[model samples]
Target: MPQIPSAEALRHARAALATETETIAKAGGRAPVTDPVITPFVRALRAGGFTIQTSASGCDALGTCPACQNRYLYTALRAGLAHAVCPHCRDAADRKAAVAGAARASAGPCPPDRVGWRGAAIAAPPA
Candidate 1:
């Protein structure tokens, strides 16, 4: 069975294509009809069950979420957030926060002395 490429591998392939596209554009030339290096990546991606669609004007490969393996991931502002986020990871974080909040609410205020910090006065002198 063919091994599925990792997220890093995918990113490297995308970056290489982008660089090639930019270089060609700067020289007043159209994007290459084909890239030797990126062709293999495209093939690997298709083999791993991803659709290959090149951007109209630039080299932007959009397919699959490298993080959670979700198809809905994108680099754009989320609801009430300035930064991008994967919905899968965000939802998981929200659920964890809710559980932690409930646990803290039931536990009441934690004692500061038990928080595991040592004062400088409690340190032993070097021999």
Candidate 2:
């Protein structure tokens, strides 16, 4: 089980949740909140390979629990919500993954006409 989230962490989560909720509502979509609901927007979480624990209120005001980062409403009557990110250093990890991925892709397999010059294939080592 994960520990409770810090106030700062919760603040970050709340901001992110609001951004996503507004974006969804603006699109005229009634997205029922769920653990899977954030899958699309949690790219940072995904890239960092962090597992999230959502609460039963996943479909509520999109509020996030400080303990589990679960989404839920302030109350049954408030439209506002609270959220927090997983404490997995997902942001930094994701950035590293992105940079590493770009480096890997750019250094992909050599062309058919090239030959091994170390890990890199060159022009058949100039014959």
Candidate 3:
């Protein structure tokens, strides 16, 4: 049988999690919790399946990556974003985008007929 944490321990963990959440919110998604006194409690709650709800504007929080299902810290700038990816996954996405962009650029310009109205306007010969 597994040992269960006491009520006092759970309360302390909750408080620690709240404090860290506030710190991250105040820092605008730039600060990570490094307080020696609080980190362990927060980590414990997280490992025990506690979830912290972040603000809609933005926040830095520890979260599980939806894509990889691995726990990681993620920062979101807005509400619409899926803020679950780790740094490694984000870097990989950026690299992939860069490669695709390079491929498109090297594929040469689209034929004149294939160009949209905006493209045609830009490419039109001077009147």
lDDT: which candidate is best?
3
Angstrom error of the Cα, residue 89, model 3: value is 35
> How would you encode candidate 1's per-residue C-alpha lDDT over 1-127 as one tens digit per residue?
1223335655666676778789999999999686554454554344434332222232332334456786533222112111122334422111111111111211233212111111111222345
List candidate 2 stretches off by more than 4 Å. Answer: 1-3, 34-127
Q: List the candidates ranked by TM-score, beginning with the highest.
A: 1, 2, 3
Give each model's clash number.
Answer: 0, 7, 0
lDDT of 3 by residue, 1-72 (tens): 122223465467667767877888898885564644335444543454432223222233445555667565
lDDT to native, each model: 0.35, 0.32, 0.36
Error of 3 at 70 (Å): 20
What are the clashing pairs of model 3?
none
Off by over 4 Å in 3: 1-3, 30-42, 45-127
Q: What's the TM-score of every candidate structure?
A: 0.27, 0.27, 0.24
Q: Which lDDT tens digits does candidate 2 get at residues 1-127?
A: 2222333444555566678878889999985574433433343333333323222233212333455554431111001111233333211111111111211221234223321211122232343
CA lDDT, candidate 2, residue 61: 21
User: Model 2 — TM-score against the truth?
Assistant: 0.27
